[model samples]
Target: MEQAKDLLAKGVLKPGDYAYHEGLSDWTPLLEVIVANSEPEASPTPSVGPSLSTAPTPKAKSNATLVVGIVVGLMVLGGLAAAGGWYFFLRDEPMELVKTTPPLKVNVPPNKEVEKILAREIGIWKITGHRLPVIDPETGGPGKAEDIRDTIETRWKEKGKSTVSTFSPVINGKKVSFVGYKEYDAKDGVFIWRVKGEGLPETVSKERYDPVTKTFHGEVNYQNNTRELSTFRRINKDRVHFKSKLFDADNKLLGTSEMLFTRLEKKEPDQPPMTAGSLTAKEAAEVMAWVIGKWETKGKGMPVGGEPQAIEITMEARWKEEGKSVEFKYTMEEGGKTVSYFGHQQYDEARGIFINRSKWGDNPETTSHERYDPATRTSRAQSMPVSPAVGSKTTTVTKRIGQDKTQQTLEVYQDGQLVYSHEIVSTRIGRYVEPARPEPAPHAPQNGLVAYYPFNGNARDEAGHGHDGTVIGARLTADRHDRADSAYQFKLGDHIRIKGLMGKPKNVTLAAWVKLNGQQGRSGADIISIGTSVNIRVDSKSGTGGSSRTGRGSWLGTNAKVNYTDTGWHQIVFTFNDNTDRQVVYVDGTSMAASRNQIPIFYEGRETDTVVGINGRERNAGFETQGVIDDIRVYDRTLSAAEVKALFHSE
Candidate 1:
């Protein structure tokens, strides 16, 4: 484009050479095209010498230019004609046109049978009952049974989304109010009962309704070791029969309550009435989801006339595989010792069978498989332990009483005679929390390092187990290596308080390096104390007085004479063995005297578990360490004497 413009500007158009404008298809003689486009007042061309090329007369140039223009315009019009013809008329075939159809609609409604059950239960009921078998604290015999009245009000709301039931029971001049929601859980493929109220632990009940019998039943589990077998029967549209039997974890029947409820009122539901329907084959076949929660046996009551005191076991069930199966865990803490186990709980829907397969510590694996008879609402399981192979097969049968509760019995047979029996009436109590994912690497792989406060300036849990200590009145000091502020120093009221982590029954080892000032009376000062804000106060009183050891009403230990006040850094360890039933004291990794505790030295699972450097004293009076302490580590499992020594020397 620049070259063409330059040629035109310089009067360089050749007479016989062709010229063309943008958009023109045909080219015209240069002299003719220039003459037609030249301005009227532009300078006339100067004549060239004989060697220059020239054109014909101006008139002849005009005619040739006109001819070229006509040809170009014709070509342009022809191209436009073809493009427009193809776009408007040539792309389609001569076929018939059709219109779009609307999408199909299918009916997906709620279960008809379930809706019918809910409708029948939508009324207020008033009941009266009695609590039985209360123990007499003074006479050591049966006490007067307590009588009570309860009001159960149920209503359906939010257009059939759920049924709400409120339970208000008047007992011993106290009114207990609880609200429960009964709804179908889509994720679990079953109906669930959840209730919450003041002073009541969270409870959940799994319900089943039998249409033929017009009855509903459920097992209700309280999070705090209590469960009950409850049944509901609609005698007529005007009344319902309700019965519940309460039991503790040790399978001791606490009492029974039977209530004949009269319908007080009913509210009509709005709109196209909800219908009832049955569950799918898959939902009816599986029970694992209904059991997904924490379950505990109430540690109350016992064998009417025997020892073996009530043993409470807390079990947790968590689901996996889209609720097809669960992983179960349990812990039992009794007699200063705790036992824990982990297992997989799975169900085979096709075979109407479920299994609880568990393994603990170095113990053998025990697998219990249960076959359910749906018609009788009962299941029987045979458990076999391999490894330390207890060859005896134990059979357990669970009878689901109503929609909400179950009763289970275990019989251990040895050589054809029943050697042992364990029974429990458990219920679903609470949902499981998602377990935390552990860090890829642990700080130290040393055996049983549950909590480690290195005190490298601040009390941080280097073990990454999250049990960090709070330095109450300690100041950072220099260590032997002259590492500034690596250890802690306490003077007068200076101390540290570590939250109690010894809730469960386990052998524990608390080891730390300490250096105390050789001051008078500082001899018996506490190095550490474990307790709640109130109970389980393990005042490490000096190894001196019997009163400190016995009747101080605290589990007291002391430098009684280990002489930590020598003004030199020494290793101190507290080795508590729930199994051995004693708390041993060690100085510089050497064992001192041992003491038998009134109760095993386990802590309440609560805050204020341990107070360091002070003996039950937060202020002025009690013994406080005037010393330096470092390298505090706590373990959940017991360490042998050799292991404790190794831990100290490892520093």
Candidate 2:
């Protein structure tokens, strides 16, 4: 109690002071502190020192203690202040206290889900027709179908010499003549013929009837050749059908076309066909199996004349195939280097036909069919017609039978005349042997540019100045090192700058041999500017605003430097990278220190226009350094440091 009273007397308890509570650390009101203090004082007062009367005045002791208490309290408050500042202001707050919501979930649909699958069904048919019907004169109607059979046979005999056979028939009260012709030569000396009569319109005009014409049109075989000439009759104005027989020159029956046609209804425009599936690994293996094994080809197209020549063509069908279909590639040595051509056959089991497409050299579309022939142990195929523009020729392709079955021969015919023949011998090896990769050409410098000068030694400037005249005399040195500029100078009045070459340029390099003798000790002049009229300056003094000098050493000249020297021959190369932040200039392959300036200073006097030996004013004012110039070139790419050095020292 005494100690408590002494502490209280010293004014240590502030208004917010309270007894320490176990649960809550917050300061209680001073009233709570006073009540807690009073209770402690009433509880105990031990009667202690009687000899303490002689002790120094208790006031001095109390004052001294009060001072000490105040000091201690101040120190504690200062420490609390420092700690509070650090926790709330200086230090980072707890990350958990920060109110941050989780990232919003983005729902990306699957690629397949986003794509709309469209379904289509394609119907194909092989039509064959071999019969005809009779006609009634009185009713103008078709007679018994059986009776016309004899008439058709008789007409064929009468027109056997000519290519066409005709029959007169009545249909729907109209007299119509059905005409048919044979348009192809068969191996048996027979040609396929078609007959159209009554109700049938003449689809094959005389212009398209001859064998030469049919061949020119790209018909595959005698059967198709005849069918192409057959005409269809419009039945009920909604349906059309045609029937014809294919016969050889000897009038022997070969094939027929009994085609049925229906008018296509107007529908939505067709979308590009999508591939349904690709060849499986097993199917690929099977396809390659037939191609595996060494084979040789004979016949005219083979290397040796009509003799089996040793040739090797390896077939590789793998991911390298284009699009969705697998490709059968045949690579073999022709002449000296290995040349490769591919026969891409897509087998649509559902369609029952293997569509074989091939390309050789630069030939146009040549196609064929692959039909399995068990007897020959090969596929019988025929080449599609070649364009008449391709020398009025037709090429026939035959895949021969053999254990390897990889050899094929091609025969080209022009107007029924045999032309050239080629043979392709392919083999299938068990192991996949990758084709040899050709050695790569030396890598060109990334910043290098090359210019080819095609002009003769006689080129003139726009101002009608020739090589020996003022234009060339004013710009070139006495010794013409750069051959391109030695004999030519583009004059001012020429008004046209024809690039010696023809092509679009992505990056450009400009080079020239210059000898500037015009006006000395000036700055801010220009020799050539590419982009805009006011984009480039040759020489000029710094701080010269508008109204700068036009020639060498004008305001355009920076740092009092004469990029256009009036002395000897010097090669100047300027490279511009349209893609970068800087342009470079090389004076004999050595880079010059220059300020970063925008390309093509555009202005009447600012050196923006393409000028040679002078500024835009057409004034040659500088020191007039005279020298012969030659060999000016330009490149489409920037030159590397090494390339610039090479150009400078190039003889």
Candidate 3:
């Protein structure tokens, strides 16, 4: 008490410092009690010593009683408040407190939480893996990826404000589909993914993040019947997983969607990926980016599926890494099926030309070395679809007719002969149509293993049959499970041969996982080629993939439309039941169109003469499997459909 009095006399201790009481659980400043108990001191004179009060101050009994009563009243009130707090804890309603306006600040960061989110989202993130559902056209809700490669890039608009732009890649170009913002209310705790531009009012989604699980979930709240719940979970530093659930205005659950993304590494826009090149990888990539959007034919059309009527041709372009090139997919209706041509383009500065390689149907891949004239703004090339056969020259002039219209004039020459050529106009389309979820893959096959070629470490066979395959030009690459695991990657002239492994077999079931770097090729891309006699192979002509096991069928399964040649690791199984004279082909565990040939497997070469990548004797015209193959197995007996399905699920 003496030390406290001395400090108070020196103005070092304030009245509020005495905030605790002997029996209290909570701290409250003793402002009133301390001030009343403190005696006022006289103004300081020249002397430093404090003058003591000679007379003692007397207190009345009534005053003391009053003070004691006040203290008792406060104690009772505090206890009652504490008990009430505990009682209302289970109620959902939050306790209200006296609110006050915050003082205006000059320069302070708003919502450090938002800053953390933006930090993780600074660069472009592309949708590489996806599991979104097909939207019901009538419901008008979210759907699966439209463009094969969907992307989003974020940027800071200002301090505490940000923008997000969504992108989609077409055959040879890219376009922005949607742009929005990350906004929050200054007075409330609500954070939003706000979209307000063009002709509509703002659309806002209340977003929140959980640090513990690294999960982000939000709902787009508006007056309409749209109740979209979206979530994003960080899989790692470079990857993020997203999901969406739709709900009606009444909060009833509707449907859901999902996608996975990998953040694109940032690079210098002007630097090329390769050091020794006329056009740097970056420059070629930039040029390719300009040509990546979708282009559709105008009012005019062409014959489709042997029909005289015109059909629309759609071309989409997107960025592909390998050679730092751009890839294109040209799709059209032909022969009652969707036919697609895939191609890649790169620039050669030394040659002052751009080279385009396209493969489709039975047509040999054409490599066009063309030059772009900036003055004429035209593209011209001289090449042939077939080498050393009939040379052709192509010249194209494109002019932007309108904001969404482009007119192109094309002229072609075959050898010295002039071909029918004319001017055609195409319209620029934005975004893409949502796609349905892809069919699920097959489970792995267990038991009854005959010839198992995991292709791990070496081409040594694991089947204990000693029918090992000899790897030729194929290289070992990362398998589906892990980067350390190995798979045979075949490109161009690469192949594998297993002598006497598959020849003159009464019944044989072959299954393997294949990832096609180039699903499209001259003639067809063969997974396995039997060089012996009958000229049989599992091949895809254009995009209509079919195996000889299912007699005269399209790539479509027994049901509706499907293209089995999509670029991915698909488990393909060829089941030949000699007794039943029946054959079935499965893609990723789902039954696809197959051809039937009861004739048993036979070959003219030595027994077990089997080949992969390319078929001998022009079965597929040397169209090699430019991709990766893994976990290949050749069983002497056919697997039941149920067994096949179980195998797919097991993997």
**Which candidate number has the best lDDT?**
1
TM-score of structure candidate 1: 0.29
Among all windows of ten consecutive residues in candidate 3, which has the lowest summed lDDT?
Answer: 76-85
Best-to-worst ranking by lDDT: 1, 3, 2
Q: After superposition, how far is residue 59 of candidate 3 from its true place, in Å?
A: 99
Per-residue alpha-carbon lDDT of candidate 1 for residues 155-223, written as tens digits (9 for 90 to 100): 663325567554433322344334455666545444565544333233345545555656554454433
lDDT of 3 by residue, 86-193 (tens): 111011222222121121121223577666655666556665432222232223343323222355545443333453332222211322122345655555544455
TM-score of each: 0.29, 0.26, 0.30
Point out the higher-scoring one by lDDT: 1 or 3. 1
Off by over 4 Å in 3: 1-448, 532-539, 542-566, 594-596, 605-608, 618-621
Per candidate, the number of residue pairs that clash is 29, 91, 34
Report the candidate with higher lDDT, 1 versus 2.
1
Could you give candidate 2's per-residue lDDT for residues 253-372 as a string of tens digits? 322223333423222121112112334444534554545333333323442235545545555654223233444555677789776565555554533334566656556545554444
Candidate lDDT (C-alpha), each: 0.49, 0.33, 0.48
Q: What is the C-alpha RMSD of each candidate to the true structure, in Å?
A: 38.1, 45.0, 30.9
Q: After superposing candidate 1 on the true structure, give the runs of residues whose Cα lies further than 4 Å from its correct spot.
A: 1-445, 500-505, 518-523, 532-552, 556-560, 596-598, 602-607, 616-620
**In model 3, what is the error at residue 208, expressed in angstroms?**
94
| lDDT accuracy of residue 144 in candidate 3 | 26
